[model samples]
Target: MTNALVFLDTETTGLHHDRRPWEIALIRREPNGYTTELRVFVADVDLSSAELMGLNVGHFYDTHPSFRTDSPMRLPAGDEEFQTGPGVWLAVEAKAAVLVERMTRGATIVGNNPTFDVEVLAAMLRRHKLCPAWHYHPIDVVSQALGFLSVLNLRMLGDLLAPELAEDLTPPVKSDKLSKLCGITPPEGDDRHTAIGDARWVQRWYDRLSNPLDGDDETTSVQAQ
Candidate 1:
């Protein structure tokens, strides 16, 4: 088990391999219970695909700080000194630099669809000649919840299975639903598709699974401090 975990989430333009992340969130948790957070809105986003996909991730059209010229946010080249904070506006280059500085390279990642988050972040990092060296293993919240459900003999991942068989099928349980089935209360409304909201959901879900009460010994702690 990884003693350090970085719960990550990204709100992107679309669902395909060509998707671009416009918002990113990270919550780094250390064994001694120390926590740090960063949330930023990446500027220079090409929302063409987002328009095609009808994507308004995190209510981006209305909430992004960059959309308004007078908004106070940390900018890499401005007089504000570029401090990290939630809901700030940042250019991709600046965002990549800050992410490289802030990301824990050794922390195992935890997220729902963690690979998607990793790949998206990796693309942005590599664009600036930076590489992600986080711990090789990642915990997928959906998979973890599904594992718990599998032990009860549930069979509802037909969406994945049907893909192998080349059939069009929708699973009864999506990732969020699976998280909820395992006792995670996801955020509501505007926060639904936001990066920080989802990252917090990952953290809450993992803590719930790892620290069950009533003498439940089926789960173990993810930290070692």
Candidate 2:
């Protein structure tokens, strides 16, 4: 398998079925420590709905004011100033092409709970008349952690391997929270909602799982493998 992993995350307008992505962040990391990160602000959606989803104008203007003017339609200017009728459709198409090209190179997509990201990306690609080119099976860190803990005796595993994750591993344990699984605090600050920040956290959690600190037993050691 390729040692390249693509950590992806998206910030959407809403969680509704018809919602669309406004920002996307993809980080490609290699075993040699070479990393390439891409963050694109897609301008093909209803900004009004994005406002309702907590992505207000102030948020964009403060962080990326360029998105307002450089997007499909130039904001602060009227709809008459729109450069394209479809609103940045070409930009969306270009970004989608980049994503497809990178994924097709054999890099596996990884995310905290990647299903939503994959779904949103797929939807965006279809909307732009682009094909979803990545592998059907993406690596979901949350799901992997949950499945690994489901069959094991948490109490025993905790005592035998990761005592830090013990208390949080109570019976009927139900959560994919990285903080709970890794015994680390949830990421804060700019990392809270941004795609790149969240992707970094996902990568951290995955790294911990790949090289566990303490796991001598069969079950726990298998997790490291």
Candidate 3:
């Protein structure tokens, strides 16, 4: 089995509040070193209620794959390119069918905030009458990083590793801070809100958390090998 199942992210039309994900990206790593990836934008979204800030942050107007014909992964002329007519509807349905297979094959969804991502994904899938077959329990990278660093809570080691934790930040540090401690630099600029970039960013954090460490590396490494 693959040690790391999947890394995922989405760009939505609303802010942190209830929103709909219009763009999706994910990466699945296999034991044999092959990686499967997908990046797509769902053209159909009800932006009537989308927040102004949400549209700004996600660059909804600027980088939406529909307008960007230069995208390397852009579907052929008749596919996602068609904005109107029967072609567009067929393409959209075809894309949804592909997602049903690809999204569930990995069987797990992992991300910085997986709950929100999965919720949007489920809604998107259901819109096309498809069901989400991913594992019920999604993995949150922030929680995983917290657990990885929880070793510092040990009285003896707390004093030895990251001595400034007691003085600098308060208990229950935020997700961004925790990621920094794990040597993950937050993505910025275009990478900040783009689906594919953010998904890869999540993968970076997952890689850090999965690093070989004392007492844990032996078991995981053996399984991976």
Candidate 4:
């Protein structure tokens, strides 16, 4: 197990590259044989059915075995919007706290689509005027999958190249998190667009695919402190 790695996932209003997360989830791999799960929500953000439909993101939660619920699960209640930028700042604050609490030097924050994850995270930090205490970057699993396969699409890659892990995941329709790809059935709980919850799933999926113990060279921890 990678003691220093932080598996990260995020849930946002939509797939817009500039969008911000309404919730966050993080799972830290401790030096000891323990993992910590951290979840946070932006209390002020609000989303309507129509706005979410416009993004075509309703199915991301509806189809997932672990996250479907009647009431919005894993999210704070109130009026909030990432487009306002203040909510983005709050998210950065929450993420930084999770990092410090773990006492990690540098984190390898793994995600299914790291480009968007990293960009949103960095933008959130900038909005908050905060910098992560540890060096963190979004690890793009798609690129990693591409390295293992000639063609690339989450569903296609999940079907062909990801057999080793796919058996564990629920096949994704559009923009599902990496957890579904890792065969990790989310616990029976509400997945209210929390970034940290999503991050934990991504981390687990990353470990499943790039576990060092399994003799795969792809597992790379951040620069050890």
Candidate 5:
């Protein structure tokens, strides 16, 4: 059977599902290949301009160039701002329904933390009185990996299980870790706080562990075969 695995990531306004999405990233890997898509559902929200300034927006734009240029992903402006309208929620619910429906055909949803995502999406669908066409079962990557490497502590186990991935910085850490590990110092650049970019980095680190190259250059984009 061809396994369908999906890695999903989301950024939202605070921690509440009712707050709406600030960003969403989904990375899918199948027997054919791997592909990723990202969307920024809202922008310039109710918070003050200064408050918005302090947000730790991940590298959403830098990694996902296509999304950066997409029109529908852009949020509206002014007091006539976009709230969680029925149509918008309907679209999300529809997509979730499709994703869930596909899963019933034997696909597995893999995520870092799927409990929250599934809960929120389920609640949203119920709130809209729409029955999604998929199941709620999800394979949590972090938990499974932890269980697999129960011998080591969390930090050490992460490094041991995926040493190459250890190079990438996980929130709050400088992005320099990856390059620095490779002994290559990257030039000065601002990181775009986008989810797609973060997923790309995570994927890169995962890739590096499985198939390492004998290169000293840090900027190599290793495309999967």
Candidate 6:
């Protein structure tokens, strides 16, 4: 078991491994319920892909290009310093240093699709001749949710085979998306595509799974943090 859980998420220039991450967020939660949040915006990088995706997903406002001298897009929440004359621009080495400072050894990384985030960060680290700071295995919420659904389906079958076991089994229901599992209904004004917003959602999903509510009928009022 780990002493702390680091919920992490990233917003990249694109989906490919070669793409760069312009923004990253991490929320470190200790066993005592204390939490610290860090969000970083890399100063220099291509924002074309990130802009397009964010627009398509309705999270990024369709404003002036981020690279423009008079860009209209608002800086990510809590990242005002990056909104200088041209825009935020952190060198690769500086970004790496911040990541190293936050990601200490023995801390379990948690994310929605953790592998992608890990691979992107690893690529960045390698480019700077640095090694990964966290453990190899990350806690992936998507995979965990899939496993839960699989076991739930299995128990349903078992109960059907033996009625006596029905009392201990939850009724079979179609597996749903992570939003449904955590009862998260993204509010109209909520920031969606940002790294910090997504990381918080993943953390809340993990919490819900850790302490499931009574009477499992595939729906609950457990709101995302």
- Cα lDDT tens digits, model 4, 12-55, are 66766557555555656655535555544444333442246522
TM for every model, in the order presented, reads: 0.74, 0.66, 0.73, 0.52, 0.46, 0.65
In candidate 3, list every pair of residues with a backbone clash: none
User: 1 or 5, which is superior by lDDT?
Assistant: 1
Q: Give the per-residue lDDT digits (tens) of candidate 2, residues 1-225.
A: 555777788777777676677666676666565666665555444555454535652245434423644542333433211123211221343454455455434577888778888887887777757777776778987766665656554556666655545665443444434346555445576566776577767766676666567442122101000
Task: Give residue 199's lDDT in candidate 4 (0 to 100).
Answer: 61
In order, candidate lDDTs are 0.67, 0.59, 0.65, 0.48, 0.42, 0.59
Q: What ranges in model 6 sit over 4 Å off?
A: 46-93, 154-176, 186-188, 214-225
Displacement of residue 6 (Cα, Å) in model 1 is 0.4
RMSD (CA, angstroms), candidate 4: 9.6
Comparing candidate 2 with candidate 5, which one achieves the higher lDDT?
2
Residue 219, candidate 2: how far off, in angstroms? Answer: 28
Candidate 3 on 142-187: residue-level lDDT in tens?
8887777665564445565466543343456676677777677778
lDDT of 5 by residue, 60-147 (tens): 3333222344533433332322334321221233344333334333445555466655565455446556654433577654444333
How would the candidate models be sorted by TM-score, starting from the highest? 1, 3, 2, 6, 4, 5
When 5 and 6 are scored with TM-score, the better candidate is 6
Question: Which is better, 1 or 3, measured by TM-score?
Answer: 1
For each of the candidates, give the backbone clash count.
Answer: 0, 1, 0, 20, 9, 3
* Model 1 segments more than 4 A misplaced: 46-51, 68-91, 152-172, 214-225
lDDT tens per residue, model 1, 1-225 = 536788899888888777778777787777666677767667666666674443554566665656544564545564322434443335554454456335657788999889998887777777767768888788887777767766644445444332333222245457666665556678788678888788888888887777644332232323211
Candidate 3 stretches with Cα past 4 Å from truth are 1-4, 15-18, 67-97, 154-172, 212-225
Estimate the overall C-alpha local distance difference test score of candidate 5: 0.42
Off by over 4 Å in 2: 1-3, 31-33, 48-51, 54-105, 148-152, 157-177, 214-225
On the 0 to 100 scale, the lDDT of residue 185 in model 2 is 47
Model 4 misplaced stretches (Cα beyond 4 Å): 1-3, 31-33, 46-51, 54-105, 134-137, 149-197, 212-225
lDDT of 1: 0.67
Model 6 lDDT at residue 53: 61
